[model samples]
Target: MAGNSWILHRNSSVNFEKIGDSAHTMLIADASEPYEVFGSTTNWRDPELARNTGPQSFGNCFPGETFVLLADGRVIQVPLVENERWKLLRGREELRPDPLATQRPDTPWELGDRPYVPRPRQQSGNRNR
Candidate 1:
C-alpha cells in the first residue's frame, strides 16, 4: 500500500474552475468523505465516463481494490481491496446523486471485467502529520 495518500481539501490549488468550464467538472474526491467532490459542485458528469471509469475508481470500485483517502486530501486511488476494511470505504449511507442506484449494494458491488488494484491501506499513523 502507498503510505502517502493525496487528500483533497474543499479549497485546493487545483484549477477546478477552469476544469469545470471544460469537461463536466472532473471531481477530486475523498474516499473517506463521499460528499466532498472537487470543483465546488455536486457530482455532475458524463454518466458513460463515470460508469466506464467506475471500474477503476474507489467511488465506483469493484470487489477487490482497497480505497484510501490521501493524507494530503487532494485525491484518492484504489489500493488493495482484498482486505475486509475496503468494504467500509464503500458508499453506505452517504448522500447520492441517484438514490435509487446508491440504495442497492448489489448494484455497486458487482464485479467488473477489468478491476482496479489500489495500493494497500496505509498503516495507521505511518506518515508525518
Candidate 2:
C-alpha cells in the first residue's frame, strides 16, 4: 500500500458537510491495500486544501489516536504508540517522518491546557486628522 496509514475525517463519517473551519480528523491504517475511501470530502470536497492543510495527512488527524479499517470497511479506533511511525508513498517515492520529530504526549489533551485565545486587533489612527 502506498500509504501505511490514512486519514479519515470523523465528522465526515457522521455527515458529509464540509467543515468550513475545522473537522475532527483521524489517522487510520490497514495491513494490506489502502481502504477504498469514498465520500464528498474525498471526491467533491476541495482537494488542494484537503491535501495541503486539512484531513489528509499525518498526526494532524485526531492528534493522539490511530484507527484501523476492517475488511468490511468499518472503522475501529486504536491507540497511538509514541514510537510507531508510518510512511506515505507516491509511485516510487516515499515520504517519511523525521525520526527526531516523532515525540508526542501520551494524551492528546493535557490537563489544564488552556484553549486558544486570539489576540485582539489594533485599529489604525486616521493620518488625515
| Index of the highest-TM-score prediction | 1
User: How badly does each model clash, as a count of residue pairs?
Assistant: 18, 0
- List candidate 1 stretches off by more than 4 Å: 1-40, 44-56, 59-67, 70-78, 91-129
RMSD of each: 14.6, 19.2
lDDT of 2 by residue, 20-108 (tens): 21122222342211112332222121111222122333222243444543333466544444322222111112222333332322333
Q: Each prediction's Cα lDDT score? A: 0.28, 0.28
Model 1 TM-score (2 dp): 0.23
User: Highest lDDT, which number?
Assistant: 1
